[model samples]
Each structure stands twice: as structure tokens, then as C-alpha cells.
Target: MKYRFALNNDIPNLVRLINNAYRNNIDKSWTNETQYVSGSRITQDQLFEELNKPGFLLMVIEGPDTRSKQLIACIGITFYETYAEIGTFCIDPSFQQAGIGKTLLGRAEQFLQIYNSNIKAINMYVLNVREELIQYYERRGYKKTGLIEDYPLDANLGMPLLDLNLIEMQKTLI
Candidate 1:
């Protein structure tokens, strides 16, 4: 697979892949949130707005199929003066557990290092109920910061099937 910045035309595909990765109705290869939440992970309009933000990047992993160069995985990174935030990360269920997500995250960190010479850390928030996902980040050198955030009431981000909170995790890259 090839990795690069997402383009304007990639919004629709990215939305589909992300929803599939997180929602139950679609082909959920892994990381399925169907048991806990319902709705699309994000909308094309939100993605388009995000893409237009300064220091906000959406990276896509492209498939190798010659006839259709599909977007197989994607993640978003937003830079700040001292640290960066990695969110909206997902891999098409078909590509999950194949080390593609790990590789993409590493490359994203490297990209952040190159983009900000003084960057100190990368922070992300994962659903507290997803213990597996929390462990996944912990194995990647992320540590819980003892902070918890309430899952917002925004329906566009998906309605929680149960009460949920977000756990903050950070990996210092300095």
C-alpha cells in the first residue's frame, strides 16, 4: 500500500472506510463500535472542513489494485505549538491486524517530527470502554494521563449505546 495526504476527492471514500471500520452495519473487519455506539463516525462535510484547517492533515493508505486505487486506511493529525493530537484514526477492517495501522501510526509520528522540530509529544483520546484499544495504544508507548472526558452528546459523532467516557493517552516523542 502507498501512503499520502488525503485529497479533496478522497473525502467520500475516507468517510465510508471510517464508518465501516467503526460501525456495525457495514463490513466491520475489526475495531467495531456497534455494540456501544450507533451512527457514522464522521460526515464528508466535517472531513472537508477538517482538511481545510491549518496544521491539520488527513493521511490515507492507498491500495495497490491497478483498476481501483482505493483508500484502505486513514488517520488525522492536528499540530499544536508543543504537541500534536492524533484522532480520527481507522483502518478498513480488511486491513486490520496486519500491522498496517501500526506502520501508519509510526509514519505519522515521523511526519510530525519532521513538521515540528520542537514537538514534544503526541496525544490521543480513546473510548474508555474499549479496553482492547487502550491496550493497543499502551503497547505503542502511550501512557494514560489520568484524565477522562465525557463522550459528547453530538449525534453526528455517533450516539453511545451506553454511558461512555474518553480516556486520554499520550506518547512523548521528544
Candidate 2:
């Protein structure tokens, strides 16, 4: 219900939330990547480096009420010269399917429009094997750009269980 920019102290929780959403098999959701990839979704060191990058914005959605203040969702946006890239998006498994991800995504786009009016579009990369995720974005107005890039296996985001590539998806904001 509450959204704000992520602070340095949020890295550990972000790491856990992302890993559980993407890699953990116990509470599998449509977002889980464990079927196609292995290892942690992201590491603290990687997230720390990303947080310090210029033009990067990491936003978190908190649970309603001041007492609990739990992190329910998070998304990362990186502004580029002509557009922005969305990544590191996840919602707590308990929070999935309740429109939280959709609301957070809209908030991220709105933030970009306000903070960087020149940005013409928003882009994100989804693993090619994630058909359901691709459809989710498509339904949200993103179109496949027909661009495929090799997955960054060296980035330590995860190790592929099957051959994997990233496909670009874009939504024009202007």
C-alpha cells in the first residue's frame, strides 16, 4: 500500500525476496525461474553495486499499516538516454495474484514519467523460456521487440538449467 525508494538497508531483504520469487521451489508461483535456472537470483554484492549506479532507481512497496511495515514487492529501474530498463521485479509469494505487481509496475512507470520526462519508452528483458511471464508483460502493453540477447551467465544472477536467452520487451510511454 505504501511505496518508496529502497535504502541501503533493504539489500538483504530484497535479495531474499527476489531469490524466493525466482529460484526457490517450495512456494512456486508463475514467476519462478527454477525450472529453467539454478542458483541464487541475485547476490548482495551485485545489488549493492547496482544501487550505487547512476540513474538507477530501486523502489519497494510496503505492507499496509505502520506496525508491520513488511516489504511486499520491489522493482528496479535504470534510466538510459532514451528509455528505462526495468529489472529485479518481484513480489512476496503471499502477495502474488493480488494485483500488487501490476500496481508496483504502474508506479514505476509513473515515477519515470515524473522524474525523467524525456524517457520515451520502458524496456525489460525476460528469459525466453518464461512464456507465462512474457504473456504477462504483453497483456500489460509491452510488445516483443524481436531482439534476443545472450543471457549474462557471467553476471552470477543464475546458472541456466536449460539453454536460455533474454528477449527484449518494450512499451512506448510517450
lDDT of 2 at 11: 88
Colliding pairs, model 1: none
Per-residue C-alpha lDDT of model 2 across residues 82-162, encoded as one tens digit per residue: 899999899988778999899999999888999988999999999998898899999999999999999998888888988
Q: Model 2: runs farther than 4 Å from truth?
A: none
Candidate 2 residue 163 C-alpha distance from true site, Å: 0.8
TM-score of 1: 0.94
Lowest lDDT 10-residue stretch of candidate 1: 23-32
Residue pairs whose backbone atoms clash in candidate 2: none
Model 1 Cα displacement at 146 (Å)? 0.8
Predictions in order: lDDT: 0.88, 0.89
For model 2 the local lDDT of residue 20 reads 84
